[model samples]
Target: MLSQPLSKVLGKKTADELIRQGLLTVGDLLHLLPRRYDTWGELTELAQLVEGEHATVQAQVLRSTSRRTRGGRPAALMEATVTDGASTMDIVLFGGAGLMSHYAKQLAPGTTVLLSGKVGLRRGRRQLASPRFQVLDDLSEDEREALLARPLPIYPGTDALPSWKLAIAMRTVVDQLGDEDVPEPLPAEVRAAHRLVDALTAWRWIHCPQDEEQWRAARRRLRYEEAFVLQAALARRRVEHESTHAAVAWSLPGPQSLRADLDAALPFRLTAGQVRVGEEIATALDSTVPMQRLLQGDVGSGKTLVALRAMLQVVGAGGQAALLAPTEVLAAQHRASLEHLLGPLARGGMLDGAVRATRVHLLTGSTPAPRRREVLAALAGGEPSILVGTHALLNESVQLPFLGLVVVDEQHRFGVAQRDALRERGGVTDPQALPGSQERRTPHLLVMTATPIPRTIAMTVFGDLDTAVLDETPGGRSPVATHLVPWEREPWVEGIWRRAAREVATGGRVYVVCPRIDVTDEELTDLAHGSLGVGADEPDTAGLEDLVSALGEDPSPARPLAAVTEWAERLAAEPALEGVGVGTLTGRMSPAEKTAAMEDFASGRTPVLVATTVVEVGVDVPGATMMVILDADRFGLSQLHQLRGRVGRGDRPSLCVAVAGCEVGSPAYHRLKAFAETLDGFALAEADLELRSEGNVLGAAQSGRRSDLDLLRVTRDARVIEQARGEVQAVIARDPGLEHHPDLAAAITERLDEESQAYLERA
Candidate 1:
């Protein structure tokens, strides 16, 4: 019954509306818990009501009047004075003559009613204009008393079906539900330990609570169930991985190995944090059990260097290593950085170098056919080398022989399927097997993200992976000074360019980041013609109604978002940068074009580069000392921090000016302010989670699907999550197959859909 389609229970029309909101099955409707509850006896205080705020008040009508409008086309209007026990307010109703007469009859003097609307001030009196009203005088004394005693549920509803209508639909389905319909998923022992109610009782109380305590208890049970099922799934995945998977044990390099050679050739000393994390990774790689690890570090913290050392160890152990980046630009940058670090050693067999040297190859979508063939030949020959590329490396044509280590940079940018596809290619010969016997070995996986993930988030999203953090930066890298500039203030905006000029004058470079590539001509034409129509020809407005309902209509005219193309032109013409060369870079540019632009900026031929967030990660230019972010309010705190990291890489002092286009005191402005005040990526990550809510932490944020999490908030319910994880680990340890706890096993299957299971499996 719980698995039955909503249409089978409710009518087709109502089911379609519910489906539009992503609720499909009977169980889905049962879980659409009320966001809040309203009590008839606890009326809103009219005297405390603020103008321009929505309110719901229960009051008695003192008097009522209906009159015709004075306009040539006559309309009817009804006016009444109503009073809660302590305060009086006026209510206005406007409609056709017939509707006004109907309203007047329903709102007669001495009538008690419930009204909800936005409060407005009319002629020194508080009034509810065009309010929705429910007459209570028609109800019997017992019915009125019952309403006053019970809490009314208010669901997350739509304009077409408000809270009351949804309540009726829920009542219809829940009335037919029984113990068999909602089976208990938690083990009896666990339930008794946690003092949680049975699943059926909890479901009923959650949707139709008689009082506050019943609802609270029901919510607790459901929240725990959500966490338990998810954690159980993760624990099961861990068990499967440990039992079934094996990886090539790439032991520590010898004193004369490439890893040691590179360490001796390094220009700077590694931070203590880096050394610690490197040792942790080295230990994992030396194990035969497949390594699943997450490396999280702040920007410019030398994550790439640590990853390269691990890669070198694998290569020195007679196994090839692969580094997967999210973009071609970053992939190219990695190859270049590796070559520069390796010097003549990168040439390997092609040039005179150390005996332990190995070649570094680049494979992206745009790689020339001949060069691609050469790279493939080297990999097919089973040579110990490093391969760095984007998603192109995931193609079936590309093979990694004796692949040992897989390093994913900016792991959040790629989906689990992409990462797993490359890891599955690691096939090596088993030493203990007979000669020529090959076995499929899972490569040691290390995923690195510069965007620091909050603690709870890391535990929930990456629970299957062991984590290491590089919290310190190498010495001599100056900390970036951040400032927020109001976009509306002309002088403050001018000061940004002047500051950029000053940096350039000192032989430093500047990066101007914008929110968009460019405003197209078609967009301008649409704006000019006000062509935001809802016809089939205007498909862009398909969801306009839903958006308007969610956000409401803003009275202020919309402003154009800053664009790199336009800003680049405007900045070049600015007097402060009149003589400084300016170049533009965007994702739309060809590979050659992007390389040329970056080369120009790096060489000081173009000391200033205007770009989008394409340079947000792993694009290093040490000479760039200033970053100016236009419409910075459009970016999240983590992204703003990443953009700021592009500068301050050199020894010179650096500055980042965020030109906020949002009004002061708004949520966006507050986010910008929080970002400007801290250089700690972890702190900003927590703030970002709080401000934005943990957005689809279970793969949806990357896959563009709805999150599996419904009731569990990673941040607020950290303790509950921790408890669930501990209990789940113990349960799985005793019963790896969960045969003794069939209900709980079923719950795991139900909670993790195909995609989510794939995500957790890859982890």
Candidate 2:
């Protein structure tokens, strides 16, 4: 019973209170895994140490000096000298004596201390500052040497608390748990079949592993747990709610309804792709099993028309439909386009009179209560026929009278829960429920996105779903002629702007884009909120303070990048492009404001729109054929591709200029270059994933898109993810109840941690 709380680790009792939330248990502690492991073991003589070598040296502190800032503790500056058998080396410790009070107070001026760090030559002087130090106690030389060997785990930590300290603290607690957390839920026979370890052993080995041998044991256990719960939960709920759910195979008003709608809506001819996809959708909507289809296309590839046509079938069958988009802008775009494309269908009564009107109701967060209530009523009464909205449609208050189909736009942005929310609107309780009005009816789904999926990935990722790719763009829209300019040759922007200004003067618009609105580490209190989403990331104010304090006596370095308004100001003030009214738009801007800014650019009111990626998704300005991307290398290929799509909308020939600054090179350069060379978005998406760094893939989990993982370079393990998913599905199909397969259930239970579930197939 030597169990002390995490208070010892965090230096505060408050964090220990987190144990009450189940985060302090040894099983949970083990799951707070290390991001990396760094070893500073190669003990070498200072004279023998080469530049860039991470060398460890035993040195004696020769002298110490101290200084105080305005009100903070005075940092002690230490200068130490170390020697081997033949030569001596000078080691400078910038602020160790005073800053690290605990360490300094423990070691005397002339004491023998061991330093571990990389050797660097600064201005011809060998330096070893801010090196981690260990005081030699009564421990034997071999014991200390063993502790310094190989790599030590680096836990995820905050600035107030370092990872090394966290690991040490965790190790102490884990020692008490001995071999496991809860007992293994799987049968012994199943463990042997899958060649897996019991749950307790897996977690125990994961956190306090003696070697890499335990990595798979821990990982598989966690992965299984995550997948199993998600699947089982979905299944359990689906079956429970099946009674009220109506699984309607066909909602069409027979051949007469389609013929009448098509006959009345024949203003524009459907492209072959659109026609084919429409038929496929109709067939899916009329099917027995719940339909899950993805309609993929490049920008302006005529996707909205296909979606609208599918929704029309629900209308034809006496049922209502809803279209959900990720953002207000996108939702609005879809609403506008949906109205125009299905105009003939919505007017309902007349076939040959005035302009055809589609009774497509719009629902978003900003919608007035009166209007939303009206829209909701209309939807229940099947008056609007179809509804278009953002996540507001998923609200519990939004009732569906007879919802037959639900279309999710930018489908990848949503997760299983969000999609399931809309699917459950018609009343299918969960996945196990058969089609029809039982517990809850289920609606057919048509997921659409502007990004085309690679055929192979699409097949595996959406194995159970049908798919259609809109590969061609409409005829009149010209392909943008793209050019790539290296960082040093960024002056190409001048040439592009001069030419762009000339074009705008003759009635065109220009879009100037940067990778980020502001890189300044400080967030403006006014502009820190996310426009469309409910929440945002909090600033690490404490961490920032600690970093500044760690700097000893220098002013805090500014974070790079300018915010939207600031960027707009700088672009407008450019002496070379004076008087070019520059408007700004970003996630920081209000939806109404962003819409207004975009409208200005579209109407040629603002000739130059200096923006971030906000304009990359929606906001079509056909007049904006001239796009100048500053610091293109900083953007991912998929993003660049999306930006490139902003133009080339009109009949006019469009131009895109991607400019890179000299300082940034390497992989980024190649990525931008690849995007500039091809207009193919799918190719760019793959390249973007491949070239992306660690932060891009794993950081957005808080946004509810945790399932979006990248195994680009880890293509070797892709088969494993697919195998797991398929195996899970097959297991469920064979044994809908876990009563028959204890081993599979056990494996899944072990792997279902928050992080594992988030990454899942994508990781």
Q: Write the per-residue lDDT of candidate 2 for residues 1-763, one digit (tens) a residue.
A: 2233455534454355445445664445655766655665667776777888777887666544443334443345544555544555655554334444545444556666778876887777677766777766655888677556634667766543457566666666666564433545544644576677877666556566655566546666655544334444334333333333346776444546643465455676778888777788888777656676778788788887787777767666556678887667777777777656555555655664234234777788777779978887765544536778877788887877567788887654555567668766563333323334356556887877775323223332424345788887777788899988754554665677678778788788888875455655343221222222221211212112111211222223233433566668776777766777778766555668877888888887788888765566666777778888775654545456777888889988888888764233566556666777778776664554344322222212211112332222222345444544555555566676676866445544454555544533221
Badly placed stretches (over 4 Å) of model 1 are 4-25, 43-149, 158-160, 254-256, 343-347, 431-438, 452-462, 516-565, 588-593, 665-667, 697-700, 703-705
Q: Could you give candidate 1's per-residue lDDT for residues 729-758 as a string of tens digits? A: 888989999998888898877776776777
lDDT of 1: 0.78
Best by TM-score: 1
Residue 29, model 1: lDDT of: 90
Overall lDDT per candidate, in order of appearance: 0.78, 0.60
RMSD of each: 6.8, 8.9
What is residue 554's positional error in candidate 2, in angstroms?
19
